[model samples]
Target: MDRKSVVNQILSLLVSAAILAAGTFVFLTLIRKPEQEASANPKPKPPVVRTVPVLEHDGRLDIVVDGIVTPYREIEVAAEVAGKVVYKNEACNGGRFVTKGTLLIRIDPRDYELQAKRLTSQLEQAGANLNELDVEVKNTEELIKLAKDQLDIERKEVNRLAGLIQERIVTDSAMDKAKQAELTSRNSLVRLQNELQLMKTRKTRLRSAKELVATDLELAELSVARTEITAAVDGVVVQDLAEQDSYVQKGSPLFTLEDTSAVEVKCRLRMEELHWLWRQAGSQRSAQAVAADYQIPQTPVTVTYELTGQDGVRYEWQGVLSRYDGLGLDEVTRTVPCRVVVPDPRAVNLVGADAIARPSGAPPALVRGMFVSIQLHIDQPDPLFLVPEPAVQPGKAVWVVRDGVLALVKPLTLIELIERQTEAGDLESHWLVESKTSALTPGDRVVVPPFGVLSAGMAVEEDGTP
Candidate 1:
């Protein structure tokens, strides 16, 4: 094989010329292909950053509060009178119920009965006196008629005497004597008439002594009635003060009754809670706790109670939203006094359990009387906005890439903060949000890490394409 020539010196030069031409043609063709393609379809400039498609997501919150079950109605029984223990029913406590007019305890009836008997005798005496007055009135009526007749006779004699003396038919002395006698007799008749009238009037009325006795008798009977202690209302007898046949003093204690009317809830909403919660959803009367104002199944009320546990299941009792108790004194704490009725404790507990939490995810149970942190929505939608709250300060800035560059757009404020006593974030800790103007802008070339050179105008390559 000759390196430079082939067949002969002339043949070799010709062969070389042909081979060089062929190589040169192939090389030019390959070079022309890239230039032609480059002009036909130009590759785009890379973007400064990559972005994602945003979709609207729901953003409501569920709020949770700490609370406990409480009774809508409860009472403390106190005695109106004092008495020795005598007839105390064995079953008497907070849980017992009784019927109206039921006898709770009996005091000694001997003394009361004797007093009643004495009153009865006195009442009979009063009746006898009344009868005697009736007889006296009848006799006085007859006497009145007699006195009228005598007065008429005396007037006739005086008239006759006056006429005779004026006509000079009778002596002066005789006329004067007749006049004096008539006047004396007329005066006596008038006195008798007054006496008869007085008797008639007195007969219609009972004597003061008789009236006094009658009142005493009635009182005695009333005292006797009190001896048999009876339940005033339909309730449970919670306290028993006297035993059967026990001696008791007037106005002494005998027994106590508890009105177990119906079940209700007593919720103790703190003063601060009223402003934050829907306490006005139900009225005091419509609320379950108000006994007279509401019915058990039909009515509802705000009730409250205390939670006496730290980490255990707490028991709930009922209470009411009673009137505020501020008597001529300053309050150390400004919490408003609120009462909740515990009409149906089970229902109340269920509602309370749900009403407390405004959680974005699985939340812990709210304990009663404990303070909770909350995030509240303050402002509404606006034309201009900044970065969303949670992603703003912690993460790097995100922007839309354009023409191999970055276009920074306005951001949305995502989270609304309610600064409470137990809130997680502090005002001073939010330095990034405050100094956002100096750090970012509307259009700037940005570099997103983890994805190399995701430049503007770069093809949106199929994800996971190697």
Candidate 2:
């Protein structure tokens, strides 16, 4: 009975195992069919990328740099003549504006006037002495002439006496006396000639003395005028060291006037920025001229100061690239220091998106110590294509998409990297590159961000491409 029962149980187990194996085989076949179909019709997806159109740039590059405002001219007014300040104009106070030639201070002119009067008296005395010498010289010349005539007459008389003696009409003693008189008259004429020479020498001394007195008088008069200190330019007094009743010595500082008519912006430029500027200047000037001077071109620039707490509101003033501030690059910054001069510091334009929305008032003047942004409007020598900064890879290459394929442009002639403020007041950077390379065109699409394993001639699909 046990054997029969064991045989039946084994048969049932075998049947169950066969059924389970069949079900497993069926499940494998179903999965394998779909896998083989997929392997036979393979569809590889291409890498997706973002693209931006390469736009043609206007032949102008704006190099924006940070700068600080400075006065075009700072004049330290010093006392030319030492005296007590008897009067000081109200405009001579600190922070006051003064027009050119405005009286700023008056040193005690009474002492200068007295000194001038003494010099004048000395000059008059010298003039009188010269006149007297002239009169004396004239008298001496007349006396010499009269003495010569007398000598001639005495000689004639001696000759007449000699002739009478020869004719027995006169004695030998009378002839001798006439000869002696002629000798005496000759001595008198020689004395008068010596006196005339002495008078001429005296006149020369008197003339020299007169000239010296005249010079002294001129200097004295100048000192008198200098006692009244006047403003040398239309400027604002930033310092006032001299006050009424204060005594000042020669060369003492009285005030400091900053020229308000114009202002200078002190800025620094990198080597690349200077290269573009120099290249543009070289095109307009002769090679010889450039070599001789080698100066920075006076390119027009806009000096802008963003208003605090005012979104997108900037005060802009027109200026020119005046000159290099120093002879070489700055030691700490390794940049060339330059200056931009605004002819009118008060002439300001409210610029920006929110400029029109802001309240109207007097725009602040471009004074010293104001941090500003200077935009140098430089004209490029050639046309360039603008590409987004992210599109430019390291080593100056850009990925261009054409016909659903990616092409790598290597060794692009990058002119500059510029930043512009968008309408949303956000700054975006772009690369300005020369279009002469032929790798990039105005209408070409450039791959931007979210880059994958990029290779030349790789199949790529634009994100928005159909």
Candidate 3:
């Protein structure tokens, strides 16, 4: 209680109080220290990046194109001879089917028949004239023979008279009369010979006229045959402009027929797409190689169309690569036209070759102008890797995930780039990549797009991966 005792006690109490304060501060710091330490040096959360598997398989690329179907053959039948239509076939109307050589229309044959009859009559008359002239020629030759005989007899008599005169047994007047008789017979023979020659010339001219008339008759018969119009091909009548009792002129269009036994699809493809197709179809290893060889081989193709049924099934038909159509790059779309021919759409089966079971409902045939899809196989035996379009980055690089780490890799071989315009008109490009690098292999995961602030060697977590 004294001043010194009080100071020592106060100092002890102060020291004790300071120790207690220090102990309380240590207790509070220990209690709250965990949160601050955790805030300062925290374990990082891996960035969640979307990823897809890298699939390696046989490079059977399926190329799709939109096109319209058309008939393989279309023909326009024209009238070859002018006449009134006397008859028309039942199949001559629009939308009716007709076989080859089926009679479609018949023009009036009376006129052509009369013309042929007239020519035949002329030919008969010419022939008759020739026969009459030949007979006259024969008769005139007989008369000429008689006249020659008479001249010979008269000459002999003149010679006998001359002998008698030499013997002084006959008068000079008798000898002169015999010579005059021989001269008269000789002149009559010359006149008969001239008449026979004229008859022969007439006969020759008549025969020539007969030949000309016969040719005219043949032509008239041909015209009569042409009056019966017939179908030239097995097809469907798309348009029929001829009717019974209708007068038609030569070269007038009678009907338009569409050969529906087969159909053609007219489609367009890009240059790159064409290259892929050439690679599939040609014997060369690459499209460039095929082009260098200057040969475009015909390849197999498949055509499909979605039916109107409720099953959402597609019907397919087999076809072959027909021709390049050579419709060079379009100015508007920069695509080249191609043509495919399905030999017989009616022969197509309802179910596809790869189908496990038969399809339901009746199959529909390929109609003209029906919108269809075409599939062409562009498979290469070599292995190829498919990375989803989302996983592809700029510069033709891809974000590959290895052991949960992101890597940017550039493949060595880029076989092709398929670009398709979406319904919104935006071009979406998908790549077909090939690589010999051991770093990239099948079953590896690739980071998809929108990977927030991703870099090489960055740790990533695949969304939805167990």
Report lDDT per candidate: 0.47, 0.87, 0.80
As a whole number from 0 to 100, the lDDT of residue 87 in candidate 1 is: 61
RMSD of 3: 7.9
Q: Look at candidate 2 and tell me the lDDT of residue 216.
A: 85
Residue-wise C-alpha lDDT for candidate 1, range 346-400, written one tens digit per residue: 3323123433533233222222233222211111121222232332322344444
Pairs that collide, model 3: none
lDDT string, candidate 3, 1-466, tens digits = 6799999999999999999999999999998899899889968899898776776645477677888998898898899999999999998999998999998999999999999999989988888888788778888888988998999999999989988999999999888899999999999998998888887777778888889899999999999999998888888999999889999999999999998779999988888777766655554466454343333456677898876643545678899767876746789989887888999887655543344444555454787988988987666545677656766666677888788888888743555566645568787665666645435688888777775787899888889542
- Evaluate candidate 1 by giving its C-alpha RMSD to the native, one decimal: 13.2
RMSD of each: 13.2, 5.0, 7.9
- What's the residue-level lDDT of 342 in candidate 3? 95
Candidate 2 residue-wise lDDT, 152-230, digit = tens: 8998998788778988999888888899999999999999888888988888898998898889888889999999999
Q: What is residue 74's positional error in candidate 3, in angstroms? A: 1.8
Estimate candidate 2's alpha-carbon lDDT, on a 0 to 1 scale: 0.87
Sliding window of 10 residues with minimal summed lDDT for model 1? 375-384
